[model samples]
Target: MAYQQPALPYADNALEPHISAKTIGFHYGKHHAAYVNNYNNLVAGTPFDSMSIEEVICATAGDAQKIGVFNNGAQAWNHSFYWNCLSANGGGKPSGELAAKIDGDFGSFDKFVEELKAAAATQFGSGWAWLVLDNGTLKVVKTGNAQTPLTSGQTPLLCVDVWEHAYYLDYQNRRPDYVAATIENLLNWTFAEENYQSAK
Candidate 1:
């Protein structure tokens, strides 16, 4: 069966100003859709065609012959998670367990933001910055190209896509500005908490 593009949980304009409707339109409708289509084409009639997205990801991971499949499947999953990680009313500060975890791991919430911002800003070329749970500890990590935390033995709790396509529609060359705004105004703490709890 062909993979389907997952619909956004909210309207394209829902995360506006910080992340515009225009941005989501292209990012989700074009970029993400392309990956899903490409993945379907890549897997058609193959033995791996019947595998779930996660199964394909793990099975074909690191296999040179399957690089195309890995890229498409990982990007499809990453983009879906990335879109859900944003909301118009999101960002400010996390509370409860998420807050305490940030404080415990990074000293303070502000410091955690600073580190996350830096990671997003400094990810050379197209990639993503993630707040991941590795062995029950939270950490900030960056993955280049279609790489994801799943391939690294880390469970992703939250993520911000630093790919040019993710921010160019809004911030253009100022990728750092987009990252900062996302951290301040678009991060979905509830989604992060849910992912954290599930990973544990």
Candidate 2:
């Protein structure tokens, strides 16, 4: 089956002020769509064609001969996950079990934010910052290029795309501002909580 780009959870303009519709138009409509198209084209007649995106990612990851497959498949999956990680009504501290886990694991929600922001800001190039479950503990991690936690045996609970196209049109070169705004005004805690619960 051909891989398809998933629909954005909200309308293109929904995340306005913090994230412009123009950015989503290019990032999701163009870049992410390109990855999905590339992945489908690359695997159309291969054994990987029948695999799910995650399966393709795992099968091709770190295999030099399958780098194209890995990069496109992983980026496709990553962008889909990234869109869901944002919300028009998101942001603020989480409540319930996820909140308790964050506090317990990071010492406090504030500290968790610090770690996540640091990870997102310090990622040296095109990559992602993630809040993942590693051995039942919540942790912040960053992956360069098309790398993802799925390849590292970790379950990603949330992610923020730090690739320039993700924020450049709106924030210019101020990546940290974009990262902070996303965390403060757009992160979908409900989605993270659901991911955390499902993993457990």
Candidate 3:
């Protein structure tokens, strides 16, 4: 049950012009990978050694004694989900049920993008901005550091990493630019749709 950095769905360079290969190289290859490594080591030979990352996250959440394990395990799962939330063929508007749901929940897709970007841009520090299903209602939520929506019983449909490491290389101090570009060109609506369907 050792956790590993999940493979990128596309080439590191595939998201070019929007997000650079170097960013993914560092973000996915370094930071994300490090979290997985830490998670594996922390849980080794412990009762959590046999638990899935999500299970460990849920079990240890809010327990100060296992905070290290919770942080690393949550990051491992979050990064895996974050990777799938982007794609070379993604971004722009979605179609079908996802489209209808976005309209229903956020008034319109543009508004949803606005809200998502604002949340990501305003996050005080290393954290995540997410689109999640909370009690069957679509909502936007932000979690600081290694926190995740799952611990709050929300099913995350989409997420954008707001940690400096996620954008510093690509957008420098221009976090808003990075957030805007990712929303416009990198978000994988298909993946979001699948997650939404499953959550429902």
- Find the candidate with the highest TM-score and give its number: 2
Pick the lDDT winner: 2
Q: How does candidate 3 fare on TM-score?
A: 0.98
TM-score of each: 0.97, 0.99, 0.98
lDDT of 1 by residue, 46-118 (tens): 9878888888988888999999999999999999899889887799888889899999999999998998999
lDDT score of model 1?
0.91
lDDT of 3 at 84: 95
lDDT tens readout by residue for model 2, 46-128: 99888888999999988999999999999999999999999999999899999999999999999999999999999999999
Ranking by TM-score: 2, 3, 1
Q: Over 4 Å off in model 3, which ranges? A: none
Alpha carbon lDDT at 183, candidate 1: 93
Is 1 or 2 the stronger prediction by lDDT? 2
Candidates in order have lDDT scores of 0.91, 0.96, 0.92
- Steric clash pairs (candidate 2): none
